[model samples]
Target: MQKNKQWNVKGAMRLAGTFHFLHSCASGCLLPFLTLYFRHLGLTATMTGIIMASRHMLALVWRPISSVLARQHDKRRAVVVGSLFSSASVVLILLLFPSEGLKAESGRCNASQLNANVAEDGGEFTTLENLPQFNATVYSVYNTTVVTEQSNDDDTAEYTPTPLISNSTRSVRKVRSLQEEHPHSEFLGSLKVMDAQHQMFFLVLIVTGFWEFMAVPLEWTADDGLYEYLDFVDATDRHRSAKIWKQLGAAFGNGGVGILVTGLYCLTGTTAEFYSYAILMILTVPAAALLPLYLRKRERRTSGGFKALQLVHGNSQALLCAVTVVLTGMASSVVSDFLLWQMQDHNATETHMGISLALAHFSQVGFVPLAGRLARFLKYHGWLLVLAVIALSLQCLYYSFLWGPWTVIPAQLLAGISTGAMWWSVESQCEDIATPGTEKTMFRVFELLSLELGAGFGSLMAGFVVQKFGLSVLFQGTALILALWSIALALLKWKIPRQRRINYSRLLAADMTEMSESDSDQEKDWLETAMDDSKQKNKWTMDKPSK
Candidate 1:
């Protein structure tokens, strides 16, 4: 029996970890690439931010509803429902409103390439010699015209009608009529072919982001369930091992899929990449369903109250941590949403972008387990989180000075360390602080209070910043905010007593036993009340008979 129970626990962990991996595989395909997709639609940075912010905004509401359900019913139910909703949304959006803008840049040819291809058609090759390589300015937009005129000492003019040029997602075509009239014109400026595609893309993203947020709470719930299962199996200290498994899954999921998506884009083209991502999101539902099957059905906690609010008010450290997460969220939103565009600006190809992201996530496969070991040795999760914040600040500074596309590779090491450690430490701290019966509630509340709220405001703020000042200023400003947040974290560490901080992990292991005792005590009190009521009724019956 003992051996069987242990095997069951191990099986549960593997299943849960696999689920985490699949979900991340889906996210890795979409989240980092969404900015580029939006740009393909000709939507501005501000509009992208609004779509991103909508997810976090809806998450704030979902957390509360999911928390209530978890407290009132089985936590697994919420997880299952969220997965189904997310799967449906992804499918609907992909089938009904596919964006053509992503396809515009797919295998497009530049003016020089077009000239060479045209020459090849006549069994000749165009040489680079005497080409108007210096005088011509290439404007990339679809259905736009460019006429180039060359002059010699004879005062004779030669006109060259440039083929369509596509730099990124925008493409332009030359007008034959305009080129004929401007035979002597030296240069023709860029003109854009405007359409309703950008607006259509915006509407689709908003709807898609909304459905995605609906599933957010379920993922959190599933993760917490795994941790609680470890505690139940008397493996609380080994919780990091479970997290390591999750990270490993994410590493494989992200790294493997990223490479495949890039490969597919090169082969079948851009439509292949978008459809592949949609399929990944759909796969998340079945993988997510597997998680709930292994989760322990939690005992119901008392429902309906401002537990989240009370937690913030009662715990000064928690409040400070929440504030820091807001800054962290603001910083993260800017980097995750715009980093692709930055890479593109530095002349990175789709394959290069995919590889860079894969490298970053793969780097975490090693760093996350190491951070867990370091946290255990230090015996203080709080300081580890502070260090993670310091790492974030450094990465932000690095991004501010970004010159080459490869520069982002080194910064990703910082990303895995900071983000992975911060989440692990924060969840552990929440477990320690929660009252005996309200563990999941506390975790969910803090997650929303810190991560979601911060992410939401950060996305909104990033849009406005990108619009007004520019992308470079956004990176610098994020670094400055992180620096300030680090100081605040330092102050929080100083104010909170070391003894109190060290006692958290010890207290967490006893929460279940304490809850059991509390339930027994409540049962005893109810029995005593019922016996007293029976005695009073007997006395009243005897007195009435005598009268």
Candidate 2:
């Protein structure tokens, strides 16, 4: 009788599903209400868009810094704690949930402390019955428990927080049981049938990436998923408004997740309810693991912090990587923009490029899992780099100098291949050379700077070349230079030592480290600061925004 433990696909799926729920819910739940919150703070839609975009742009900086912080600090703990901050952000965001939703909520049900924030201790888990005595039609409360046959008398499903609650039936009377404990019984304040519909449909549409990630463990063994994803996606070109529409839907969805979580909090109307979300995010299980180590470090007994980050086997190489990443990122951007340029150059409609770009997302969801194959093949960083440079160079030439806009279809496919392989190469290199506990952060910076700094520079560079040298000169010259650079990277990829290996576990572990949130103020402050910095990137590059 292995109580508290069951191992099987169904069980795994359940556990994994729960994790997936948290992951997706956390990632995509913001948009339904966050902008509304910002508006409450007296910002317009355009202003809100700017703020949101700024936040993403700031992520270019934070992604790396946070990665570094995770490496130096506790990766697992950071994830858990990070979750807390994310949760708190949700609550704060809810304070601004659309008043319409709130008004709709008015006097609907007995939301005990519906107007309140935190519930009393010893009174964990909420239900329609336990809510305030409003005698209304609907009930919105937290700490609702669902008891299944698997539950024990101690009530094990306690900490599992439900994100929302909407009920249609009114309670005949309030039943005060010491605890709602019964075997083979489930608490159904929620519409299971409707929830199943929403969840199943949402799962179908949204969890496209989740199942792919689930296969990571299978990488060490046989993998058909990877190959299949790549084989098909590598051939795709999302060249339609429908394709772009899907991407827009996703972006908007991500934005919506932020808003929805906030709405949940506002619905609660409890004091410090927002703060508690922050607390929950920070207290995710991963963060809890670092408590002892953190406690010791707090006493000045050395924390896991590192002062130096290594590149190239501790060869005292600094800024070399930074420069490399910046250039590579610029190159990647050039790849994207050049294809667009070619299409435009050939009199292709703006709609074509937009659809083509949207196709990139389809490729992303399709290719990432399979991309690992190329990574597997080119286990060495140098080899990976060579492959990337060569692919990108060829792609540039094909689109700019040789083929016309129609050639862009193949160009996008190859670019995906190049990006896929480039990731493997850099990651392989990073793994071989990275300092312990700092790899995530180091790579974070690598990716962020390379992508953003590169795109920023590439856009300008392409613009300048087109303006001064003529489009022909720009395209041909870029191809020639990139070709040479690709050859050099190939030489390097071939030449670098083979001792370094970036295993799947380390990569997964690193990702998991920052999966959680920061403290309420920490995330808010950081995001605000990031937004401020981003505004400077374009709009107010000279002056920082006032906090």
Question: Number of the top candidate by lDDT?
Answer: 1
Candidate 1 vs. true structure, TM-score? 0.67
lDDT of 2 by residue, 153-226 (tens): 44432333223221211121122221244322333323232322232323322222232222122111111121
RMSD in angstroms between candidate 1 and the native structure over all alpha carbons? 12.2
Deviation of model 1 at 453, angstroms: 0.8
lDDT of 1 by residue, 1-547 (tens): 2465444766666676666666666566566776676655445677778877887788777766774565455656455556655654653454354333322222434423222223323321112211243123222232123322222223211222233323312333243345566765323422223334444555667666666656566665665566666666766555456555555555554455556655654344334445655566567666566553334355654552377558656777777667666677777778878877777666555666776777666666666658768887877888777877888888878877777767787888776667767776777667656665466566556667656788888888888887788778888888887877788788878888643333444544444554676674664455568888999999989889562
> Which residue segments of model 2 deviate by more than 4 Å?
1-308, 311-324, 337-342, 361-381, 401-406, 470-472, 493-547
What's the lDDT for candidate 2?
Answer: 0.42
